[model samples]
Target: MINLKMILRIMGILSLIEAVLLLLCAGVSLIYGESIINDFLMVAAGSVIFGGLLLLMGKGASKQLNRRNGYLIVTLSWLLFSAIGMFPFLISGYVPRVVDAFFETMSGFTTTGATVIDNIESLPHGLLFWRSLTQWAGGLGIIFFTIAMLPLFGMGSMHLFSAEATGTSHERLHPRISITAKWIWYVYFGLTLALTLFLLLGGMNLFDSICHSFSTISTGGFSTKKASIAYYSSPYIEYVISIFMILSGINFTLFFYLAKGKPQKALLNEELKWFLKSIIVFTAIFTVTLTYTSPYGVGESFRKALFQVASLHTTTGLVSADYMVWTPFLWALLGVIMFLGASSGCTSGAIKSIRLLILGKMTKNEFKRMVHPNAVLPVKINKIAISPSTQSSVLLFILLYMIIFVASWLAMMAMGVGNVEAFGTVVSSMGSVGPGLGLCGPVHSWNCLPDGGKWLLSFLMLIGRLELFTVLLLFTPQFWKKR
Candidate 1:
């Protein structure tokens, strides 16, 4: 049975966390001397009151949480965060429409980076900080952040961690899950800080540096300027951001292992090998194609190709140039990279490198099986044999992912979106990558999309960010039955 009281208590605690985030934004507003401070303060005050009341209602809640409660809590926490997170935009009158505000906030929290706001630069500093902050918090995950920093969920932390963690497996760096969470977060924060310093060295102002750093490390592509990374027009900035994007795409567990003085573990990781090799191969192909086909020289082509390949491969979505004008083949190539995202257990979304690695090995074994019927070949990663259940789960996940992509594509087309735009938008949204093809391309905001289309894409972002099963399982009939 679902533990309603425990759920409420956790929700209340999460709401308080949201209030703290809002107040931090309000502090920014005050420093900037923006009148929007009132809006943030008001919404934050409301959050505190609401959270306190929920805490009161959950006063005698049980400490234990089952699997169902964990799933429900994780899903509902995201929904609740988005619901409350939208108010700042609404109250500021910056995003006037309810749907627009909700979509923007949802995009931020999901780190999908799709935006309806056309003039991002015109927003006050506070809103921009809040906008970027949401992605940073979300990139590592909100509950996971709580698990790392707070000891509130004493008994059922494992349930919460398992419910939200992506990829086929959840590996712990430390014996204690909370300690593992802390180590991973430490790596995440370290990357963010290092990237910010690099951006500053590239001549970006402090605010833009911090914001872009947050977005980059989160694999979120929200830019302070409408032109995105293109606005700077600096190869230095592009290269730095690209390098950090690739770094952020690495699994935090690998970073944890390195931090714990076990560099060999990360070096020998099969998924890491696949991911880096794929980036090198994709970047080389794109660079060669652009060099011969476009006006770019070899150096320019390499720079652009490396940045774009790294961005989309990590699902970061920060664009340095308009790839829409490039050869049509490049467009399709990027879509594939976006589909095969960077390493698992990091900020990136989409079908992860580990799953792709497993699938590739599985395919190879199939041919071997056909040639030698009696031979037993086990799929392995890091020299450890993968269980049959894991291999099957990976296959099923990819199948369902494609099925949903096709279904959503058709639905978007039926909503009056063009075929190419519909395809790009669906893939981009579902992959948590920003920028799409045709109308939804890099140069454009999603402001042109119909409200219904925005809502549909918003739903796609949520499920995609949560990894299909977490949110979808909530809709399953068996999820709610008492065990």
Candidate 2:
């Protein structure tokens, strides 16, 4: 049987920690003299009470976690945390509808960068801050955060850490999973703080600066202004964001390597090299095309090309120019970028570059096999041959991803969205890339989406963020069967 007691204890602790964070938001409300302080207080109190009950009831539970309990805890933790996280928006009456509030909260936690809220500036400073904080929390992952800070999990922390951490490859910078989690958090925080300082220095107010920094580091594209980065109209702000978006998309494990004085090893990573190469290649193509095709100056064209490439490639989704209005070729270019996401083990979503790289190598070997017949040609990564099982897993993942995309596209079309819009929105949501090509394009928000469509896309956002397998594995009968 699963250790429900232990799972509940972990969830309870996480809830408690979340409630404490809510209180900090409440503190922000008090400082700003915002009318939503009462709302924050109410939400904080509710979280505390709910969390307190779980802690009290599960106090006698065992501390250890196994595979079953780890999956159960991680899945339930996100759902419950999202549910609790919605209270601020609900209580504040900023987003009165339960579905909309839940969608916003889920988007925030998933770092999906999609928003239903049409008027962002009208939201209270405290609520906005909480929204940004949710992205930061979800960016590093709440479960991993708990594993790092809470010591009660003991050796079992590895189970929870593996479940929460993105990517097929797990590299530990420290001997213990807890220490590894802490180190990653340290790097995440450092980057976020640095971005915030730069944004502040670039003429944004403290609130917008902090919020944008949170979103940037998370690769979550929630913006304080309606026009996003375009609202600033400052090339400096855009430049800072462009750089950080790329950085956020790279694997933090590589960051740990660089931090540990192994910059050469980090640079030698095949995925990182291919990732940069892809960016440069695509950026150059788009810049030249846009410059020649459009009336915009060379400098303006280059800026737009870099921003859009960085945005879609990193899955950051921050837009300065409306690609919908740009040449049709540029729009197609972004769609391609949307499908090829950031490096593995990072916060960015979609079919990761590492998987694609493996697939490319595998394809080449298969071609070689056809000609060589009996000769052995193994697929290699980092100068090491990949096992058949790993190759099988990557291929299967890609197949399933494509299947999901087609199904979602069909479903959205049936939901009354136009063919172009449906395909764009489905791919965007499923890839966690935020913007689509048509109605859901960079110039438009998902606000106009039907309720059914919003709910569908929200579910897709969660699925994509968890990487299809983790969430889909729950549906298997074997996953639920008794041991």
Candidate 3:
């Protein structure tokens, strides 16, 4: 039922492209006089050789990718890419442990901002740039890259796109998926470029600005400095980053509509409304709490509250302040925000607010049904009644998400992680929210996590980014059944 040859062929091509990108990283190393150039080159060469063999062997194969094959390909592609992605770190001896390297690569590809490297400033600029680039690539999605550039896949593109695309809904801005992919990336690239320029103007070096821009637009939140945004202490820079993070979390499809003079459509979208409302409500609460209870001035409290709420809600994980030291109430508030994530169909990760909104409405309708059994009520989004199938799918997805989250949390606890740390890491990893509350908190890294915990969290990150069904379906017997 799955096209193995076609999957391998696409993987080969993707690997080859990744290898080429690594070579560019090697150039950066050389230009910056970094010592890891040879190591990077060696890894790049191996990628090319391995990919070349697959390409040659799978040459002339049919390009069509069915649904089953698409999921298999995406899952395997991420795994394979992570494997090869670890080579540079391995060869450079920067990361001696294979597990740590794999975890880092997984984080990059998943666009999860968690890191094992504690001394980020100690790493070379080239490696840092490559790290940021991986997130940028992963942010829009590797499948999207393939879809936009590799036209031969045609109908197969939808299969891969469905597996990789975020959100409970998918939209095609153009009739052709390839064209749609290009438009998404065009917006993605434009935002990244604009953010880079703004950061540079705000007094960041070209290298730091570019890296930060990549991370910001991707909503990946990897900082070159050890202190993150705190290192700069520049209000202007923080404001700019907050704006882009919020923008990056929004559905790019809406931007396209706005570009086409369909601003009303974006405004009328239920998800957008919920997104804005959530930010406003949370910001207000956080501001009130911080201003009244904390030592900071009202203005300072508002700034901190708004920044943290935006960061966590968008799942960007950029820390402008040490949130752990904040009041317990504020800490708990942020923890909840981690699960809220940003808009679907964007780079942000979590159980999207739209699904939650639908579930809420569905729950309310069910309650009403108890009083009037003969009456009919429909769950509506954007003023349209959702079909039964879509509603069922959303409900199933939420259940699966909860199961995965609980299981992950329990696993972490079993691994000897403290309750606070376990809950934070599991939820944050599953939500693709980088920082947690305790050991993996905003001020901390997962470098000290046990190997088992690192691997488990890595898997969770992958599943979360793909959304539950795409990854969980891989485990079902029916998924493997021949059609």
Tell me the whole-model lDDT of each prediction, alpha carbons only.
Answer: 0.91, 0.84, 0.86
Candidate 2 clash pair list = none
Q: Which stretches of candidate 1 lie over 4 Å from their true place?
A: none
Candidate 2 lDDT over residue span 67-112, tens digit each: 7667777778778878999988987888998888888898888887
Q: Model 1: per-residue lDDT, tens digit, 326-379?
A: 999999998888798888899999898999999999999999999999999999
Per-prediction RMSD in angstroms? 1.0, 1.4, 1.4
Name the 10 consecutive residues with the lowest summed lDDT in model 2: 149-158
Candidate 1, which ten residues in sequence have the lowest lDDT sum?
147-156
The C-alpha local distance difference test score for the whole of candidate 2 amounts to 0.84
TM-score of 3: 0.97
- Off-target runs (Cα >4 Å) in candidate 3 are 152-155
Error of 1 at 480 (Å): 1.2
Q: Alpha carbon lDDT of residue 306, candidate 1?
A: 98
lDDT of 3 by residue, 1-483 (tens): 877667778888888988987898899999999889988889889999989888887777786777788888878888888899888888888888999999988888888888999899999977898888888888888888887777854335888888887455788888889899999988999999999999999999998998888888888878897778889998888888988888988888999998999999997888888998898899899889988888988887878887788888888888889988888888888888888888888898988888888988999999999999998899998988988988998888888888888888889889999988998988888887788887678778898789999999999999998887778788999998886
Better of 1 and 2 by lDDT: 1
Two-way TM-score contest, 1 vs 3, winner: 1
Ranking by TM-score: 1, 3, 2
Highest lDDT among the candidates is held by which one? 1
